[model samples]
Target: MARKKRPEGTRRPNGASSIYYSEKDGKWHGWVTVGVRDDGKPDRRHVKRKREAEVIDAVRGLEQQRDSGKVRKPGRAWTVEKWLRHWVENIAAPSVRETTMVGYRSSVYKHLIPGIGAHRLDKLQPEHLETLYARLQKPREQGGKALKAATVHLAHRTANVAFNEAVRRRRMVENPARVAKAPRVEQEDIIPFTREEARGLIDKAAEIRNGARYVVALSVGLRRGEALGLKWSDYAVKWRHGCPKGSTCRSRDASKCDLREGRGTLTIRRAIQQRTWQHGCDPDGSCGHRLGAYCPHRRDGGVVESEVKSRAGRRVIGLPHPVIESLETHRSHQEIDRERAANLWADEGWIFTNRLGRPVHPTEDHRAWKALLRLADVRDARLHDARHTAATFLLELKVPLPAVMELMGWSNAAIAKRYMHTNEEFVTAIAAEIGGHLWAEEDDTDDDDGPATVRLAI
Candidate 1:
């Protein structure tokens, strides 16, 4: 007969687990029912230690974790790589925009997975994350170059978000990435035009194809994607009920207007971007194609319309008179192009379109921007600089910060500050006004007989 087991040590109360001295293992043991499994069985957490006190403490720790609902599910061991892939494809894909999802996927595959993906999600520690970031900063010796601080910061952010979700999903007791330090990201310099340059560029824009597009860029501060994705239906032109100078009113609103005269509004409804496709065969993407575009079973991808970056970005902007004039002229020109294209015209109702009435491709638009700057003899600047110029001009005009934010569709004041810059012209004008008001219209001479000098109280 099997030897009788020694009576289990004094029974502990519910939730405290039972403690016993196991003769075979020569160790103190405790078993706590942390939760119930799906099959209606107790999910028992067993703790074994050489000392009875240690076993009791471990059991107490388990009890606390259970009470706090911070315990990882039993038998579910997730690796960092596994969880990240799951998040990007399942958890994050459905909710986030495609472009944002792309960044998440890039960080997951390019940085996080290659670095610390093998670690169990529940076992990850702050030090492990720190080590990965440090390694990412190390100079590339054999082949790969060190990642920039910004790139590493992006990785850290991705990991932080991913781990946060894992915790929410009950895969991890806590987020290790939150305790890890992120790399500092430096601000990038932006080049925006002075008022004079902006006027000259607008004039020169008339000489190029789709010049009104650039006018909208500088005057309205619409992003390239926003402009390219514009539709004729999105314009809400407000026409004068009747003209005082013997001019007939075009129409009551944009939809009925003849584009001869009107100052209306443009609503940013969508943006165009190239989205990467995912393999349809297997969720793991193991069918030989690394990139989804290369896979034969790819479902959806390529240039597509997406929602604006944020709700704030989908704002309505009232057109300035010049912008309205330029757009009216643009519409007349577009009609001519339509007549020329005849049957070839697609008539997609896009505000800006090619000769065949198709939306202007981003690459072609980029080329147009470069040509416009070159022809204008202006300093070369990114198309985005036009937006910056708009912000700078708005700020210089003393427009309220909140109004500028609305015009620029900035989600935060910080972004507006980044895009807005004070050029020398503003300071010089201010100085001139101050000097002219305080002194005669003459430079001060070194002689003691200078005109009544304005003095300030100390």
Candidate 2:
């Protein structure tokens, strides 16, 4: 069948403007005026294809993008892999959280680099990116897995971010990813523990070592890393002396005989993360370990306390009376553990630790949480669900959304609405606030060594 002829032009002079059959290259061609040159002549982009229909479609697409402010001038060269690596290491790394960087690295190295790395950066187009997304959803036997749409969307986002940086750096003029379609991410429902289940977990936690950790998690919506990163220094105690008739009394009246009463405030400044260790020794040396962890001179990485990613992550939370008492008990046991380990203890000052006083590995922490669930006769749940459970309790308590946001350390309200995640979790940046008074101190503690318990100076 003879191909249909495209019209000579379909837009104003400044729009897509023109298209024609080209005898010189036996192809159809189009030109869109993109900008004015220094001398005032129109600076135009040339688009060409063998088929008239293809040129028309390309012209219209560019025209639409141009009008919408997402268009870019035809670009110039680097391999997609080379530029992505540079963007991840030099451009994007310093500004992102460690966990975020880890995700970017996974997407870049484990997928993008290998998939489209060989393609020229300037020549990469939306179709290429679209193909990569489709390929990513293929079965595992075909070099990809049946990944969740959200996982694929994350990869798409990584590409979008990387190319946006490329455009900013003037390394590329266009972001193909901006035009590509990523898989649709389906929102998953968050299954949080019910009030009874929370109580059951709490009852069982009492029988486990450092059970106060779970208490803090379920009571307040602290991210796993934030809870683990907590230190004795972060907790400040205030004297709340009250009556002897009740072992637990919240009454402010000081009329009755009493011992010292105290309330604890926990400040969140950093998070504990398991980082991949890097080799400190030369690769050519006698050490032959494939993984850096086995390298005797491994120097660059290990479990670390990283500052919380956002401002909301660094705030003070007022602990409940029960939680405060549980912590005191937990602290006393830690002291005993320290005495028993004597000289063998690492003394990192973590609020929760193993027998050697090292930070509890996240995996081990998950295992312990699972064991506690069995002891409590509760249904299965991820340790992170404890965060969701806390959000539920906060709502049930009728805490203000903003206060709950501050208490939970969520970055925004929309995240809080995700009910706190129809999958996991929410924050606010409350400034040094405590019961009607300024109640926090500037953080002067060293990131690695958390020591010296400062009194909660309320």
Candidate 3:
């Protein structure tokens, strides 16, 4: 394609906004976009001034490189499989949970390596990604359908992470996945409940004896594992007791149960994971609720913790007064159940336990949630959206960002920002105050056109 040159003060069509100058006011320009419009397909465009080209021709040359797809430099030829193994081993394994490592390995090997393993690291481009992603979106005739948007987004992000590592290692110069146009996330109106709605939900939860899953999720915004993995010891009702329960319990206090003057905190330590066994069935497989005075399970006769669904799951969360009260009431009910069941009930020490005193699984929680939503006449929203609700509530309360970050255990402020949109009215008022003169009132003088001529900033 030939480069096109624009005159010094010419405006292009609205669609040509994608076609940017190689250098501002330069004689040549280049453009490359994804997706097809009636106007044009996504392709490179270069402008040249044959009538009066620049003497230096730097912009023209750069535009040529873009047109021919020759801007990126060549790098090592490692296969996706090789680099992915390195990514898991060197980068992701130590930092992330074992479960997360397993999932990442599975996705890379099963989906990515088999699909794009042979492509050279240097030759890969956004188009390659687009083609692979297109196939992933199609339904299979036999059974399985396309992946969900969230899953696809994860895969894309995983690819970007791997490529970023490659760049850092000098294995590749640029990340092909970084510039690729990912499938647009379908924006569903899955808003979190307002404060009143949340309050109503909490009240409803109080009626259900085994609904601490909802309570913890609402109060602390813990993930499912963090909530389910909780044990009786994690709770500190009457006295400073055992280690904080859940995946995120504080280890520092694990050795001793010290209660400070401030409101009590629930420590998240170990999570209950469902693991397959062979030799013999573990009596405490379910990691069920333990009465602090339970009999004949271990030498110490205390609550036990086991594996959780994933590693990112183990985390600690401190509860507020409402959560503590709800928990106390819930525990009282469970104690009654345990007294009736007696030895028949499992020796498990889960805080939020069933009639059998076993820890509740995620599936059970889902079913309960669905039923509760119907009962409460509330629309269905995912469990994670509850976290969004909590974040928004905190923002509205004028809580500092750092406090929110700490409460939510967010790695960065950027992600927290995404969960809550800024208050538009506040922003507008601030802007108006700063630039009041620009919008100052003046006498209206009608021009030939219908509206009066007003000073508008360029």
**Candidate closest to the true structure, highest lDDT:** 1
Find the candidate with the highest TM-score and give its number. Answer: 1
Rank candidates by lDDT, best first: 1, 2, 3
Q: lDDT, candidate 2, residue 125?
A: 93
For each candidate, the alpha-carbon lDDT, in order, equals 0.84, 0.80, 0.64
TM-score, cand. 3: 0.58
Task: Give residue 433's error in model 1 in angstroms.
Answer: 7.2
Model 1 clashing residue pairs (backbone): none
| TM of each candidate vs. truth | 0.81, 0.73, 0.58
For candidate 3, lDDT tens digit of each residue in 1-458?
45467788887764342333345555444343322434565443333552333422544554445455444333236776788778877888777755566567666866677768788776678888777777787885689798776666767777888888787765665788989988778776556676666776777887776766687777677666667777778766433334446534444443234432225567666665432221222454233434313323333222234454334334455677667767767878898999999998987788877678887765677788877777667778787777777777677667898777767767677977667644444456557665764785554776565754445432
- Give the Å shift of residue 222 in candidate 1: 1.3
Supply candidate 2's per-residue lDDT for 227: 90
User: How well does model 2 score by local distance difference test?
Assistant: 0.80
**Residue range 235-316, candidate 2, lDDT tens digits:** 9977656556555554654323255466779999989888876677775235888777888888656778788868988999
lDDT of 2 at 200: 85
Candidate 1 per-residue lDDT over residues 258-319, each given as its tens digit: 44356689989988776777787776477788778888788788767778888889898899
Ranking of predictions according to TM-score: 1, 2, 3
